[model samples]
Target: MASESLIKTSKYTKYTSYKKISYRSFFVGLLLFIVVSLLFIVVFNAYSGSSPRTDFHEPVNLDSTLLEVVNLKSDARLSSARVSNCTYWDCFNVYRCGRGGHDKITIYIYPLKDYRTESGTPFSQFSKEFYVILDTIRHSKYYTSNPEEACLLVPSIDTLNQHSFSKKHVSQALHSLKYWNDGENHLIFNMLPGSAPNYNSVIDLNTGKAIIAGAGFDTWSFRYGFDISIPVYSHTAEKIDSSQPDQKNYLIISTQLNIPKHYLEVLQNIASSSNDLLLLDKCKMDSDRIDYSKRCEYTTGRMFSYPDVLKEGMFCLVIRSARLTQAVLMDVLASQCIPIVIADSVVMPFNSHVDWNRISLFVPEDNVKNIVKIVHSVSKERRGELYWQLRWVYDKYFASIEKMTLTALEIINEKVFPLAARMYEDWNMPEHIYGPVNPLFLPVTAPKAPGFTAVILTYDRVDSLFTLVKKLVRTSQWHEARGATPAVHPMFTTFIMCDANRS
Candidate 1:
């Protein structure tokens, strides 16, 4: 009986010890849970306090009437032609010439033929759209009735088909204009697909005064000099609150299946990996026929009607088509959605004046696969700052017709005025500057030895050689026969290299 009692007491002690361990473990686990929860709360609150908050209006209301602004006045000379408020369509008429503007320089726009056709509509519409801007400037004190009197002649889209697009003809037409020699006028060529470098209609006229647009590069080889690239915007621009939105999605890429296959693949990969929503409107184009009307109508209905589609997204993907830059980028900015540009090389309009880095995100074609990761690296605060930067770009470049026209005018002014001034100075200089020379008193050698030698190669032209020798012998006398010449004339001796093999 004593052995049985001892064994039962030992079993009861073991059961009590097990219960104590379970109670201790439960309390310790509860304490650990509370500590971790407090740490997370502290960290989250600190981050929220330190990070910048974007002041944004929710449920944005867009007003079409708000897009209207006052017309640009002629007397507001020195002011940057940027419009404070104006819709894209009506604003073209408001831009005026600034002080010391070129009243003699006229812009002659050749009416586009076949502009109404399916393929031609985009180019045709683009031509007409830009013409309004040019025409507005034309009426502002500088008007010319005759094409002969005009400083610049801009050919329409259909004109290319009429000319057979031979390089020689285009070159001659642009460089051989009446006032071209005077440096008072130039040719403005819009570099669309049919009008770009690859197109037969396109030719580098080598005219120093020519301005080209839509080409990938800013300056390219052409006649006399290369053409300068100007930013090309869409004729149709959207108006939204210039402020960035409180975005719900990371990116919204609306693309047709016609886009490069590689880009679509990358986008798919990004969509799979992304934590946020990735909106892709695969606007599939059915046929090969270039029908602008169908595409525009469909896009307007599907993509444009929903302005919230843009406002809800942080970045809009702008893929390069035939041209590096597109109207979509302008529209994206107008919608206040920051553009994520994917192109090989994109030259912006007035790029010299605006800093693009602050306004948009540029992703190289090769690095497109890593787009999600790259954008994810940017902090929310940085994105907010980029939004504000885009506002400046929209107000200055996209929404303001005056600003856009002024940028082109500024390029012409830079090229034309300097050459014209040099011509004027040479023409008006006093004869005394050349100094009188007595032709009869010819010397075997110049009074002062020339520091440089002027080598003249000839194939048996004795008469020309004799004339050149005389001019070198009496430098001042040569200027007397001609009008005012370059002040610094070559006074060096000519070493004529005659070909002995010439019969």
Candidate 2:
């Protein structure tokens, strides 16, 4: 009995010792798992943090002697472009701000001259604006020097305006440039700001000025521009009079002395009827000192600074001048004022991209009497919708100088550059280096003849054929009936023919 008892004690001790060992083994495995997990997390985080930094670093080639070659003679133009190469100290300077470096495009400024108008008005303002635009948006890169090394040459529209060079003369001059003589480099012509669209592409016999066709003119194949101007407004005055009760009413501020007679009559009629409508007309503007014509001398009315008037007005009147698009449009939009446009032919900048009808109300010039009626007819909900839409347009298109410059560059890249590339090579380049050649304005020819010739055959169906012939001939005059422009002059010509009559 004693031996059996001792054996049981020994078995119990061994079992207890085994249990203790099992517990320690479990704890050891758990510690190893925790340590491995912590190490993996630390390594993963380090790699992830370092990867983005390496990816974002701009590619730099430090070798000064290794020049980034921009071969203009090579017609290897890229259709999909994101990054532009700017040469710095003879090394390739790549900016990642544009689309990824695939399908790269190189842009350079023609450094020959600072743009100027014939009146000695310098385009330095635009140049400064453009440089800032390129920097902010990183859409283009500039070469320090040498037009020959650049594929695209951008000259300020104001410079062209100063030369009073028509598209033909400008084209000729571009052709005569030594760069063109090398059968390389193309000029992207910018039309003068605030000038009326000159659709008559041909040089005007009366005025030597190049008539930049109105914005959105189909015939304007080569001309491209962004006409955005910051408003000259007094913020202090606007804040001071913010509490005025009539501040939210309609205002028409014309700095020009002579508003169009039709537009003037319309304003007069609106003022005669509505006490809410304010007419601030002045014959002379401060711009007169700058030599820009404000208006012809005429009977004047009260004058108010632009911002003060713009602040008080909720609905502003925008009249179309020779300038295809006006600074007033940008001002009204930027101020968040609803625009009531009077010109039917007025084309908004980037019209092809955005819907203007969604943001502003357009009324025909002859229908000035309907101004108050239209304003009153708008529902409160609709007005709110228009206000938001106008605010959006302003923010996106003209909110800041940087944004405006970006807009111009976007237009060039999306609309102008591709078309220019296709048409650029087709231009009449001068034969000799610095050779004189007639400027070949684009589309290469006038619009195709408007009319088509049609032949009709009658086979013993005289009465029916005669009626059909009459209708076809009458269809030629449908444009005149609709009061359309003469651009649609003759629709078609008709010829009547007879086969042997079955009778």
Candidate 3:
């Protein structure tokens, strides 16, 4: 009160002395100040955009990271080839009070200026894979523009390809985020992470405590129940022509380059004995440097498109090249080519929810010699079944950026709110098989709508009346639900006045 009076007498009066300024003048000036403040608040809100969504029913709470990785069964481990008895949602534990179901998030993009301290940065340095990841999250149902209400956070730094930016600068960018309190509930995505000499499975950027949604994660680097194993995002995979008819002329196709000398020898020996195996090596160019976009030569001089050639083979070889997680895996899946993956340590994308046995054949790195024998063992009928199943699984879970990103979000959301999380069937089942999904779970028996009734009157028809009553008993559960479907005439009660019998 004293400060306000002093401001009104001194500052508000300007050059006028405190004695010269009248009480009316001071009151007028105060009224003008109040009006200006109100206008400022309205303008600020107008520029700030819409209010946060109120549909969320769960409360937000923070806690420690889930540490259930040690207790996981070998079958459920990320590095393990096949799916286990438990779904992805079943294996995780939330140590905190609030994390998912009601969890909402926003993406915080560092401006172009942040990319400066990183490298000789260009706007074009950001790959399409990076744009796809950002677009996928922006279009997700759980994203909120208001950061104040976000329970989780995403950073936009083109981390999809770690080689695109400097690790030190990227770490600095992470630390500069407004909500980054040791990366509590933040998510960092990396599709093609580490670079040359040592192609480490996971990127080595200082992500603090953020959840790593990355590809090429080995069992050692994977946070088991927490971190997500994503597939290498490939435009070739996304651009596969679905309209083309299915064809399988070759038994096994190996298009991978730069394999170990010993592993290459094994594949060569197998190809020598079998006419079905189509092995390809780098094409001989005039110059020493390889053009990656050019397809490898299958025959001496015959060259075909890399992934398109995969469609003609029953099984495509996913050999570990520069990295454990290969772009060829996604292309193989997209082309409906059952993957004979030889990367023994790689955690396949969404391995938690996907029953890899249905879509892929995980061959141990030591079993390179047996790959041909394994392909021959499967009958033509079984191969055809796998072909269709592989396509279904690919389109459902790993088709595009949207499916992959949403899969990660859903997994995290389920981990946080287990009670309201999606069931196993929801994650693995065919979308059409499950029919429609509704958030409201109708009770087995519900309250009746008042004044709604069914009446029946029949004379000398006790036997027929008995049958009718039995039918009604069977359908009683449906009508018991208050406001049940067929809103035209709501059902509630049943009244049967029948003939009095002496029996």
Candidate 4:
């Protein structure tokens, strides 16, 4: 009987110890949970004041007006605020753009000549550039098939390569479109837009009210608000991917054929004397080629190709010849070679949005003799900065056919609908400054960027200083509590403390 009693006692003791351990573990976990919760709250409160937030109001079961600001009534605004569903570009999602902004700035692409559609390589395409332009818009947020609902219209005719597309053929086709209406509300994309032998800046077509988004717009030809100056895109912009050389072979490279005798002489003199310039002319005959094709060659038995050769030079010369706008400008930029543009009164592509002076060196035609000294005068640091900036610009705006087409569309979208326009920083600034943005929402009223700075000057009063910081923290909490995303500016705090002990 004593043995049985001892066994029961031992079991009872084991059960009690297990219960104690359970209680201890529960309490430890509870403590950790509380600590973590408090840390998250503190971090949230600290960061509440300086976060970037854009305000938007989405009404459920929205109507069919373009996304509208809460209270904008200007003619510059798209459609009517009261009746439009989607009015802004940034605030569009599948639901908003597909259903709402569909009616806002709706772009309709005219059907191409029979058998030439956007899908699966139409048996014939004007050029890859033409196909790219059509395909991009078709996939964009602004496309529509109902001409009745379209705000902008694009032509189906091929206007990309002037050498291939006859001006007469394009004009006749454009005139016959079912919705041409004398080219009213139409936007045409033309890279090289005139007849050759003397490719005039004029499009040489009866475009009527159509806006020319062409590359060859000199100051004399570009109608300020009516036209858009677009980039002369390289045929092989995407294929070339070269890392910048640690050391370049030439300070400047000029591959312009058919330049004036004086200009050619000047370049040759610079090349021979300083050995810093490379003047390349088209190969009169290539023993390597059984067929004749373009290959730039220097007289000293050195042959070169555009862009590839451009990578070997620090700067590429873009001088005015028969044409003000040249393919070499975009070519050099893509190769990360700085452009030395000498054309006077030439308005560059997307000039309303881009700062060309930031990436290029522009000199007057009269300054041709001092070109060497001018390029030499630039510091190494400046050259590095310019090349890096050029890379950024080229990638964002001119890298591929898709980018060029989309950039033009975005510009036109902004122009017609001023309220839905992209910000200056969106187009010109580096990504790190603002980061990649979808432009999901915009302010309801006049959008104002919010900045906050808290200045606390404490003179020998540690307690008051602490109190001030606590109060500032509470202000951010107030915003958070009000259902607003609180973003304290990154540069939000400045402390000025004078300690009595220091004396």
Clashes of each: 4, 7, 0, 15
lDDT per residue, candidate 3, 398-432, as tens digits?
Answer: 88888888888777676665665766556655665
Clashing residue pairs in candidate 3 are: none
Every candidate's lDDT:
0.49, 0.46, 0.68, 0.69
Alpha carbon lDDT of residue 419, candidate 1? 40
Among all candidates shown, the one with the greatest lDDT: 4
Highest TM-score, which number?
Answer: 3
lDDT comparison, 2 vs 4, better candidate? 4
- Stretches of candidate 4 off by over 4 Å are 1-104, 114-125, 165-169, 284-299, 433-503
Q: Whole-model lDDT, candidate 1?
A: 0.49
In terms of lDDT, model 4 sits at 0.69
lDDT string for model 2 (1-503, tens) is: 99999999999999999999999999999999999999999899887865555455433222224332222222222122111221121212223112322332344443333323344443333344334433443333422233323434443222223224433333333333443332222323233332344432222211111212223222232222322112212122223321234446553333333357777776776676666567655445456553222222123344455544565566777776554344556666766677887766545555545556667778787877777777788777767666666665665655665565555444434432343331221221213322343456445454323356666776976567656755665665333455433322344577989799796
TM agreement with the true structure for every prediction: 0.47, 0.46, 0.64, 0.62
* Regions more than 4 Å wrong, model 1: 1-126, 140-176, 181-185, 191-209, 213-227, 239-246, 251-258, 275-279, 283-308, 400-402, 411-503
Better of 3 and 4 by TM-score: 3
How many backbone clashes are present in model 2? 7
Candidates 2 and 3: which is better by TM-score?
A: 3
lDDT ranking of the models: 4, 3, 1, 2
Model 2 Cα shift for residue 186 (angstroms): 4.1
Q: Which candidate, 1 or 2, would have the higher TM-score against the true structure? A: 1
Q: TM-score-based ranking, best first?
A: 3, 4, 1, 2
